[model samples]
Target chain A: MSKLLIEDKEVVIPGQILAEGMDYLPSNGAIREGDNIISTSMGVVSLSGRLIKIIPLTKRYVPQIGDVVVGFVKDLTYSSWFIDIGYSNDAVLSMKDATSDFIERGADLTQYFSHGDYMVAKIANVTKTKAVDITMREPGLKKLYGGKIIEVNPARVPRIIGKQGSMIKIIKDSTGCMITVGQNGIIWLKGPDLKNELIATEAIMRINECSYTQGLTEQTEAFLKERTGGKQHGVHQEA
Target chain B: MAYTKRLDGRKLDELRKVEAKVGVIKTAAGSAMFRMGNTIAYAAVRGPREVFPRSMAKPDTAVLRCYYDMMAFSGAGERVRPGPSRRSKEISMVTAKALEPVLDLTEFPKSGIDVFIELIQTDAGTRCAGICAAALALADAGFSMKDMVCAVAMGVIDGTVVADLDKAEEDYDKGPVADLAMAMLPRSGEVTLMQMDGEASQEHIIEAVELMKKSIKKIYEVQKKALLEKYGGVKDE
Candidate 1:
């Protein structure tokens, strides 16, 4: 009799058989091979009910709608700003999406957003031809200034934020730094001091390296306490 | 004629030592260098990134590109010369076809994954080494696939089926030689690549394929062990 050939969280290689006959239907990272279900990639398996899928250990970011990304300004068009969001083609940020204020046509769009500037924006739309449109006329979305940006794995962003913003909030409270996290794996932070900034950066790096490990939040918390020299500044206990 | 032994002193079915050194290139997305006896090849995988030339980008899947080259200093004795030779170009196409069956290109959709394999040293079975190393590098890059492909070559010498053909035994001008290369899914018994050179009888071909099937299981162990060393945390080690 055929059964689920792999256990939950089992690592599998491509073409490795997952099941025989029709006992189970194949899911992502697995395909039907003759009468058997076979894995077509290297990944950690996740079994949900009858559905079995594989999640890769590491992968490049593929754009999805509503993902807030940190992108570099590539060029300025007459009606829009072209941004490179790590894709092959440029994502367009139209002038109308940039500001509420109306400006005369061809009245220096660069005055609002120029080339080489980084911004945290949402992907408003992506077309069949891969044309993308972004918007910044939303709260907490704007042209970033006077801060250093760091890129992390997009998949691990949720872990960095922790459960209900627990991990990032701890880092923010410790350093007393302003930190904005973009879903595209771009982190913006301005710590009180360069040393504080370095500590926060290192903390994120730690998360990126070990996101799969258990007890990551506590480890990150301990890491922050140790890195800040244990001179705990209780910011949330404000009178 | 009673047979003595292989020139390298290995048994008819014995394979050479295999070492898979992964994450060798720091800059490439993923890379590995594999050595089988005297043959060594390095493979680097890049992208699932933007599709180039626009038209080549598939609306429903990703494209797989490969470049297999032998460095001028790879061969023994005199320099083999630089740039893509006719033989290298043919091998490039051959390697690409072999990898196509393994990669689930539809996952990336319009992007491309390029696998570059460089022959660092040669004895025999360089293509086999290259294909094996490329699979590891692709796994290191994290592309979705059915399975990693392991390759090995079989030859009939002195009326015996030998596992891996080294340089001395693969001489083309030599009499009564049958060199067949096979790349397969070790777990499923699916063939992704099979090429035969030199003259051989049908019986020898059938016998050689059986030998290849058994030997690649050993190569599969090596490939899996190498990947686990780097990504052991994801799966149970």
Candidate 2:
């Protein structure tokens, strides 16, 4: 195994052997001199023994091709809608990419999409200039309506949605709000009362803040009960 | 009448609540989030990459490119779209200039430094906050630099020079509102970045600059403390 430097700092980026005789290996961002492993990166270093890595304290959202994301309509043309996807530029959603069905010309474009409307889309392509072209022609991608929208840090959206949609499923089961999250930081929620909408919003915000914690489902359930003055219905009670 | 009144009940020379956190982004070379009261800015610095647009490359120094953006929701009621507007471009250019003086650019010949700052929340004084956060992130990224750059904004409000103005004070100040933003090299006392907006008498401008110098000194101390805490008092030269 060979040792290398990250940014000129002595760090053992996975697959580097620090010692010749011992099974113990230095973690990522760590220096192994003798039996001890020293941190070479400026972050909370984690060690799996298999390979140590540096876990960054902050998060940033980077768009990827073929990933489904929610976006907000900012500008409209006769043929397409310009969507703001929290990137350096707006992504285009041509009418052809909106749906496989043919859309009639001058048919009250608002019927298909109005400015400020949020929808789920897939990144079709990214140009050399980094301009992203998006399409709604896929399963589970469509226009969103009749829900109050809230914005959060784009980087935290995945955590807010939770693993395999478990976290969001809980929120939906509890608050009974038809919810949709766009990758661009727009969240849409529709509930019967202003109270339920506010409750759902608070739950999402809390999830965003406390994403690092374990037992998030239980914690969120308890939090919702305390805030709403009653236990949430349909909470998955695991035996 | 209280001699010190600039809304938010802060004194003429008193600063707003200042908070700084390091390592906000996992993918960036280095990152930081800074909040001056309600004005919150996040900065990420990634660098030592091959210079783009080969024509702009210089053999002697690293080219620094900065992008400053305000989140559409940063304002009170208006939602801003993410993109480079004229205002954002101007702020980005000024922020890049502020960081240029402290960086030992000669180290990375034909390379580039990319500093991206996003204003997650804004009340006022965003440009100064962006510069401060970007400088810290660059240091965190392990880039060699001459000194930490600390920035602070002072403004002439109601004929009195106030340090760090918030949104209400910035909007309502009746007198010739002059905003002076400066970035200083703590050890050298060198002004790396300086800019003033609105008209102020030369005397008032000088007074504002003096106030900024003092404020930036305090900011420098904060930067040092944060870095020391992260690296265990190991000074990076």
Candidate 3:
């Protein structure tokens, strides 16, 4: 009785059925009923072997473990700092998880992470209610400065990063901009000059506009090359 | 009584005309300009983003705010003022209520999903058209929902049950009679919103509801076509 109602990579909306029975295991965007697997959101259906799932078209950032995010320092608590990751609930950055050095218990929390500073941190844990705990103790994770952060659709972040970092590698080597993309649709770009920064930003927005299309990497690579006058024209296929 | 002809030359139960296009406003996440008969409504949806005014932020779910406006130039005769009035305010709330049941707002908490609908040219039944357009814009913005909502108005005109009444049919003098608007989830046959003014007998009300169900099925096709046209959801070869 188990059957897939949608083709591979077919677009589906909420409440649509993906399967009719228990033969297929449901994943993201799917809810299991007594014998049917139904879609619970608007997304593209993808089947991996026997695993059936749907990739949502629009959604909020659901923090996962080890996700890099751009967060704003919203408030300062007595013992912990609250970070607004642009999602629902604010994430807590305990003073203990702030750094490796032995900082005093209540020794100037703002000086460590102020109320207005922007930081590039990693999600250490995500609770059931979507409350995240971030950490700056990891390498390459710190408070960002002198750079501009732009927002795109978070659902398209995977295409922005490209497969195995191939797409981003082209962007980095081409523009010579220090680019870091967070899973939460925030991109931090720092370049030697504003021209390069603008180029990177425009490129990212273009990718965002057409993220769902095929051959996005080639289009992005070509866009960067033309904008930069082929100075950094080296298109590396996805690794 | 062979009075089957309507003022607009439609049958006793014929829609005027429905034309829609999504993504009209490039800046907004999703937007649409929809016209039913001569009444035109534009809807734009922008967000799952940060909520302004810290007080309105929900701790566990997202907030939906709708604003309905009627431009001064949209009316037929004299100029209408461009601002929010009591009528527009009420229409805004009812329009939001019609489509609210479709969206799963909890998916984005501490944020706001803002929808703006403007009645540029209204000749009656603008709120129903606005709700229909709002549903299209929401889908175009990629927000998932249980089912898309479709709406239509049914009224008794000249002692005849009709669907999608125009301003002429609605202006039957003697203090407007029995104007009913129904917004429903067509597939599941659930009415999420219903507004009635004027008067009708019990039997006529039942007849109007039945007539509304049929028109909704047609309008539902138009709504889905508009979404698929923008998003490329064609499965047929």
Chain A TM-score for each candidate, in the given order? 0.89, 0.71, 0.90
lDDT of candidate 1 over B1-237, digit per residue (tens): 533477788989988999897779866777998899999999998876777687988887777888888888999887988668898888888888887887766546677788899997999998899999999998777677677889988888766788899888887343566788888888767888889886678888888888888899899988887876665543453
Cα RMSD for predicted model 3 = 3.7
Model 2: per-residue Cα lDDT at residue A158: 71
- What does candidate 1's lDDT look like per residue over A140-188, in tens digits? 7878787788877565788888999888888888766777787767788
TM-score of 2: 0.51
- In Å, residue B5's CA in model 2 sits off its true spot by 33
Tens digit of lDDT per residue, candidate 3, span B1-237?
A: 423577678887788888888779887777888899899999998777677897898887778888888888888788988778898889888888888887877767677888999888989888888998888888777675767788889997656788998887787774446789889887567898888878878888889989888988788777767665655565667
**Highest-DockQ candidate:** 1
Q: In candidate 2, list every pair of residues with a backbone clash.
A: A28-A52, A58-B24, A58-B25, A70-A182, A70-A183, B72-B80
Ranking by TM-score: 1, 3, 2
- DockQ, all candidates in order: 0.48, 0.05, 0.36
Top-TM-score structure, candidate number: 1
Clash totals for all candidate models: 7, 6, 0
How much lDDT does each candidate structure score? 0.80, 0.71, 0.80
